[model samples]
Target chain A: MNPVVLCTVARMMAPVLLLFSLVLTVRGHDSPGGGFVGGLLATAAFTLLLVAQPEELVRRRPRVDPTRLAITGLLVALGSGLPALFLGRPFLTGLWAQVPLPGGGALKLGTPQLFDAGVYLLVLGTAMAFILGLLHGEEEEAREREG
Target chain B: MTPPLLLTLPLLVCLGSAALAHLCPRRAWPRRGVALAAMLALTAVGLLLLVEVRRQGVLAVQLGEWAAPFGITLVADLLSALLVLIAGVMGLTVVLYSAATLAPELEAGAYYALVLVLVGGVCGGFLTGDLFNLFVWFEVMLGASFVLLALEAKQEQFEATLKYMTLSLVGSAVLLTAVGMLYGVAGTLNMADLATRLPGLERPGLVSTVAVLFLVAFSLKAGAFPLFFWLPASYHTPPVAVTTLFSALLTKVGVYALVRTFTLLFTQDVGLTHTVLLVMGGLTMVTGVLGAVAQYDVRRLLSFHIISQIGYLLAGLGLLTQEALAALIAFLVHYIFAKSALFLVSGATARASGTYDLQQMGNLYRSHPLLAALFFVPALSLAGVPPFSGFFAKLALIRAALRAEHWLIAGTAAGVGLLTLFSMMKIWREAFWKGHPQDPAAKQEAPSSVNVGWGVLGPCAALALVMGVLGLGARPLLELADAAAGQLLEPTGYIQAVLRRPP
Candidate 1:
């Protein structure tokens, strides 16, 4: 099932998909694209890699365990709410700031963006965990049949 | 000290511990330690929230400082506070029980993290003031429970989980549909706003239809009659600790939503809606008790009883009186403690006898007198025996039913009580009184006796003691329930607090 052309295409597409996911996440503040969709995109990128190179992906596990990644995302999301509490506002109150670029244009940032980032990581981790778990189950079944 | 802090602290502690537990994958003790600390902190915060709510009336905060009906609001009236407190205490007990009984394979599967997440979801469900937020909490709980149920799946476990998951997803779909319908009709998803707007809505028929959808969805979740087939099928499949946690919190969450929605938002058509509830309650009780009587498996029998007791809560809600709601709240508090204790005791008994079948178990009276006594207290309480918490709970509910002149339901409640006693006695005679089926003389020598550790017994005893205390000190809880009932009946204060507008 692993054709050379398909593998080559997947290798190229994976990086592009990941980069696009980040763009979607960052632009989600006032647009249609948000963390949830962006995270799914990132998961799709990983899925492409796994399909093209299953053994390599399995042997060299991702840098972050999927379960831990989801947990970290949850902490990040919850932590985003804490800053508002410290500022004496209600929990999850958006605190915004403007950062000026070298060219004099300013970038607007807020707690909601932090929350979107958290959602992005959470969605990616959770989807990958489900995919990997199913793949691992199939592999085990195949091994059992061979034995 | 702030309202938002009180509402969110339990969730933060739970998720924080979950994250911490996941950080160390290979180690068990560190995760256990984190869970234990988190549960202790949860219980302490729950108590503080209860106290603060009592002092300040209704405590509410709109997240992000958003205006009412626009942003998410968290509110802790007496009922929410009480439920949160019970959830915290039950979480603590279940975590302790799990520490002793959970298999190494399960522990390595991130079991503690899942449990903490489930508790956090339960707390969020109790505290949220928006309908959509409540749905979100339900999903959180459902997701965690699905994983927990199938964590180290065997063939039968997977089958049970499939049944559970499918039915729960259907319930969620129905719930979301109802939420959408309500929003379409009223143009808002905030519960406080809904309460004010529902009665005045021009489309009364549409409102009733949405209410029925809500009833069906919550009834499925609460394991009420005709829709409760999934409960007994799946509840007995999980590990005992998992079963204990589910029995303690999950169904009650459904009942809580039912009570909250009916009293607050659906009061416009009590004659039609409450009557259906009354009939459903009666049937649920009858079916549940009869089912319990027919079961020989201990967990399955208790699972049926959970359904029966939920009927009592529904009946109390059907009466639609302040006294009735108060009695229902009292019953809820008693039921959670008694039911959890019973499940823990059954788990211990199963451990000692190496079987869950009542027909296969015997001679615990002589072999483990302490465990026998521990089981007796909750069993009797569950059967509504006097000087135990369940007696007072049942008595109050019956009195409320009588005063409300719900003669048939009141009679059904009493009849169901007698049947419950019979089933509890069935368990007693089979598990504790009868001699061992294999070898009566060799029962003490059974190797499984060593497996029943203090970790299980300690929580059982503590819960039994709590039942006893609640029985002896029933007045305070009754008063608290009365206040909570008042708040539910007259949700004006809740609405005013959340919306900051005159109704």
Candidate 2:
């Protein structure tokens, strides 16, 4: 099952996949792709890693809990809109800020971008949760069968 | 205060508490404290919205500074605000009751978070002024309810949820399609906007078809006669607290949507549509009571009664007079209070006696007189006995029907009132009047202590007192209801309020 070239290609492709997803996420509001597609791409990166070493992905202690990630993502989504309320605008109103950059240009950031980031985290967490849950479920079934 | 914030505040409070509760330790009492504060805040905001709506006539605000008919609007007319008020009251009482009796079970199941989310969804559904937004709120409500209903995934819940979730999804799908077709025809999903544009459409037949579509979808949720298969089949399987919350709020939301649409958008063909509602109301009444008569489970019996009460509401709406609308509001108040009280009583009784079967319950009249008294008031009130809120509510409905010369509907209303009495008496005799059904030795050796704790009995007594006042002091409520009815009879104020146009 372990093909050296395939594993090496997967390792190389993971970061590229993640970088492309984040780019898609940042550009999603004005263009076609956004947080939803970015989430899938991030999941794809993880799936590639799991494919390279299924045992390692399943057996290793997770550095992050997908559930906590999802919860945090939801909190961020909910909280991003609260600043608008404080500014005497309606709930979920998009509030923008002009950010001066290092060189000469300025960047525009707003609640919409914050919301997209939250959605990105939610999708990533949910996909990870599903994969891990299935792995654990399968492991439990195997143990039960052996017993 | 902005009208949109009325909707958003409740959601924010409830959802924030839910998030915090989820992140906290399972058994943390601080989460409970936060939940209690959240419930109190919800009640306060709901009451504020109600008062504001009553005083201001109708208040509507568009989210994100978008103008009306373009963005989703949150409208607080008298009807929605009133429903929200009762929901807040019910939520507060339920949370308090759960804290007293269900701290361990509820904490383990994250019941507070689920209940909060459900209430937020209900309030949101009641407040949304856009059709598709109503559907979204319905999803929020449905999603939370699905989890709460099957929190433990008990065997019966698994079976019941399979049925409940399937039918509810079908209801949602049909509603979405109806929203699509409405948008296709009128290019508007705002309720105020639709009321303005729909009447001018050339194809009356197409509008009536959509009317029927909405009627079918909402009736399925409201548990009207033919489409009510899911209510009795699944409602009684959940834990009593969850069942109580669902029983008091779920179908009523359906009725709210139906009343809103039928009164506003579908008023073009009154003869065909109101008559359809009238006949459905009568059939729903007879079948529901008959179903209740055939059931031994107390919760299922109450579940069927929910349908019967809905029948009364439909009949009142079919009449579509100011008095009839007033009667409808009055009936809504009596029903919400009395029904929740009855369910809470049954829950407390079940907790004590450890059964839901009428045959297995007895001696309550002898053993626990205060609890028995609490049960009696609401039970009689439910039967429309005089000196209770249900009596005045039913009287108003009958009087309005007779005034409108809807002689047949009036007769059916009276007949349903009598049948309602029969079922109430059935519970009374089986649960309270008869001798104890437990073992003789256990009864003989029983300790003499009446454990009618305030947490158990307080809410029931308070609600029953409110029902009593509603009957005895029906003046203020009648005036408030008449004002609400006035708002409905002429939707100009409501529409103009939402659209920001002077009528």
Candidate 3:
């Protein structure tokens, strides 16, 4: 079902795609990209790897269950809103801070960015769960047929 | 507590419990404990909110510290607070019931988490101040409900869920379209802002079109006529506990949205918009009762009754008088407790008789007198009999209709009450009064002798008792409903509170 060339390309591109997704997620607060898009990109990367090597990926399950990961991400997103309440602001009021970078530039950080990170994780986990669930179903059917 | 914190606490408790339950898949006690504690916390929050809203008039908070008309707002007027309180109580009771009756496999599959999410969504829907936020909450509720409907599903359940899912998605799309069009017209999504802006818009006709769209979407959700085919089809498919939760909260949320929007935002043309609701409500009643009359299955029959009762609610809304709205709120409170008790009783009845079919079942009055008593209180109440909340609820609605001089709807309301009584009597005769068809002596061992545990019967008894209390002490609740209706009729205070204007 697979071509050698396709497998090799997927293996090589997956890591690069993941790194690019992180960049997109972090830069989302100021510009066009955000958590949703970045999460989809990361899912695409994982999807490529799974499609190229379904057996290996399925056999060696990820350390964190996708469902739990998604739940954790949701908790993180909800938690991000709590800090403002502590500060006597509204539930989701964004608070910002500036960090002095080693390169002498100030890095702007905010709760919204943290929120986007949570969204990133949630979307990634949910999508992966959906894909992996389908793969497992197909695998079970195939095994049943063979047996 | 601050308004934002108070408003968001139920949602936080629910989501937090959902996560906690999801993380501990193997530990049954921890999951149950968390779910129980979370619902108790939700109930406490709901009580606090009700008291606060009663004292403070309307409580509004702008999330993200944004000014009104821009940021998402959470508002809890009396109506919202009351509905939240009902949802919290319903969640707690259903959790207790599930602990006894739910299958082990389903419980392990994160059923509690799903229920918590669904309750949270209902609370959010009740409390949200923005139109788009209402839509978001609807989606959240739908998402949880879809999984609940299909979790450990049978073939019939899968089919029913498909129908339910398709219809609900269409409703959501229609709702989103209406919201978008309204925003494009009014330049705001806040309910109060929309209320103010919609009337001032030059094109009253365009506004009415959007209003009708909102009506259709919410009508579908409320299980109103011509759009309620999904209810009886899918509702009877889920397990009893799930069915009870859905019966108690889901369509009522739809009714809440209808009352909220029509009274607040679409009053510019009550003659046009509400009249449509009036006609729809009447048809919904007749059709729903007739559907019940033809059914022999216990759950399906009760499902039809849900639609019929919804008709009374819509008719009350259609009347649009202060008295009618008050009656509607009172009716809603009565209906939730009564209907949930009925569903729980049906589950227990099925357990005792080994069948949901009335044709095969009988002698429940002889076999289980307590179950019969549990059944009678709600059944009589539902039939608008005296000494129960449903009677006062119906009486108030009929009086409101007569006062408004809506003679036709008034007649329909009375006639429907009679039909409701007929069906309740039919159930009583078939399930309890008559002897079992196959076992004339009614001594044969029934299948599935697993006793309906206290966990199952206790909530039913508690809910039935609540109906009794609400009926006997209808004075206080009537006053509360009257005040809530006053708020709905004159939304100026609501608007001022949300917009931070001096009133």
Candidate 4:
């Protein structure tokens, strides 16, 4: 099969994996799974796409930088602390809210879950950065030659 | 602001700075400015902690009103808060140094980001009241450090980081598993609650096992004798600024956690903890100085000394007295600043000479007399020379140990101090006095003097001066350290502080 077709197939599966990861994360407080394992599953889905496609597709993208992923994760995590600060609670205090989903049912989201996702993205991005940076070394012509 | 909020504000600032830093353009100076501002804010928080600790006995902040045993808590006693203050000072110096010394292609933005997270994690570890929270903070610091270790991506860095990552991951896993087991048996993760509840529970074997597991994890992080190979290998690869920060702070955090836990929750097992600590302390001091004796590189020698100095802190904790604790705190504060200053000077030396290896670097006393003098005082201080902070710190520890009648350990530590002097003098002889043979190509390749920013040097010089002042102000600080240590050892104070009533 052509690599392009293989990649397209994996792209279609990414959302399903992501949804499952969220489910696992939501249930993690009482269950065996938490942000780390759930995040790994989501990262693996992205990794599958990179393997199927050319390196350039992943390397040249703007948001793929591992450092940025880490930064974003930290921002989300810190934002979780904001509610606590205003309410005079401790840092990383879990805040709660209920909102309506599109299907007329309530969805629960909390600061802990948001913090979980941030950790997920942070770890995934960090692991991916190391893997991708190594794989894409050939692309950094100017960087290597300078050294 | 409340004490917990005081700690949280710094993390929040770090988080914001991490974002603002990453958003800066690749060629921009804006990221450095933002990081500097964030660091200044953190220092302000540390100062606030000082004022709070002086006013109140110690401060506590519980999350979500769930109370201890159910919710996490953050505490800042004099000991932890003082360490936080030292950490903030070290961080600001390193950031200033980084702005000046960071080589091109080092990804300055990412470097600063990692530094911020590492700082936040260390402070978090210092403040958290729950055991599980402590484990989480340890992983946070280790994970950030792992990235920083491997970020430069050289051949040696790959091998070194892989070693560091594997060891750190295993240590963290061990730590988390121990947390799980402690939670299962004790049914609580809060440190104060554990202290009150633990001695009453009758399961000595399980407690001992969990304690041992924690010891191994912390020892691995502390780079104690048997577990120290990773420190020497990985520390020399990073830019000197990063190495300086890591050398000054990382393992010391491990030592702090060990001192905290053993003093608080595991005091019932004093015979076991004290004996093990004494033996490890003796071995670590000897082994570290031996490693230093064999090294020809300036940074590697300093790296070895870090492990040796940790042995001193362990010895103080093992002695387990008011005076010993005071000495440990004093020594650690002095060591953090002195060690970091020496490393920054090494960066300046490396820039001028094009190598950190002493074999390649000779006679620096002539051209760079100021830099030579800058490195000299810290080296002497580290060796425990009279009138320096190291001498006072050692004298206090020895006095405490003798008072406790641990003659063998005290004698061994003093002997190791002599070896410490020997290794430092070796560097002085080779790097500053003997001098390098001039090479035209190497001179052309030398890092620019602009890279050795006065902003960086000024902080380091101020830090060294501060260590001297700490010796002068030793009485009040010693009183505070004794109070902190008493709180940790007895832990009834901490338990009451958190339980909000008598147990």
- Write down the lDDT of every candidate, Cα atoms only: 0.90, 0.84, 0.91, 0.79
What is the per-residue lDDT of model 1 for residues B291-344, given as tens digits with 9 covering 90 to 100?
Answer: 999999999999999999999999999998999999999999999999999999
Please say which candidate is ahead in TM-score: 1 or 3: 3
| Candidate 1 local lDDT, residue B484 | 97
* Chain A (candidate 2) TM-score to true chain A: 0.85
> Which residue pairs show backbone clashes in model 4?
B362-B435, B362-B436, B363-B434, B363-B435
Q: Which ten residues in a row have the lowest lDDT in candidate 2 chain B?
A: B440-449
lDDT of 1: 0.90
Candidate closer to the true structure by TM-score (higher is better), 2 or 4: 2
lDDT of 2 by residue, A1-147 (tens): 556776899989999999999999999989988888998899899888776764765467465767668778778888887887776666778888899999999999999898888888889988888886776667745743453
The local lDDT score (0 to 100) that residue A111 gets in candidate 3 is: 90
Local accuracy of candidate 4 as per-residue lDDT tens digits, B1-503: 87668756655676577677776776437777777888888888888887787678677777656676677777778888888877788888888888877765564437877888798888888888898889888888888898898787788888989988888888888888889998987989898888888888789889988888888888888889788888998898888888988987899889998898888877778899778988898899999988889999888888999989888888888888878887888788778877887888888888766788898886566656677778877888888887777788888888888999999988988999999999988988887777355643433343233344475567667767876776667677667767777766666666767777211
What are the per-residue Cα lDDT tens digits for candidate 3 across B1-503?
87778888888899888888888745566788888999999999999999999998999888887888988899999999999999999999998888887887678767989999999999999989999999999999999999999987699999999999999999999999999999988899999988888888999999999999999999999999989999999989888999999999999999999999999999999889999999999999999999999999999999999999999999999999999999999999999999999999999999888899999889888778788999999999999999999999999999999999999999999999999999999999999888888877664543333466777789999999999999999999999999999999999999988999312
lDDT (Cα, 0-100) at A114 in candidate 1? 93
Model 1 stretches astray by more than 4 angstroms: A1-14, A49-62, A100-105, A133-147, B442-451, B501-503
Q: What TM-score does each of the candidates earn? A: 0.94, 0.94, 0.95, 0.85
Among incorrect, acceptable, medium and high, the docking class of model 2 is medium
**Which TM-score value belongs to model 2?**
0.94
Which DockQ-derived CAPRI band holds candidate 1? medium
Chain A only: list TM-scores of all candidates.
0.88, 0.85, 0.87, 0.72
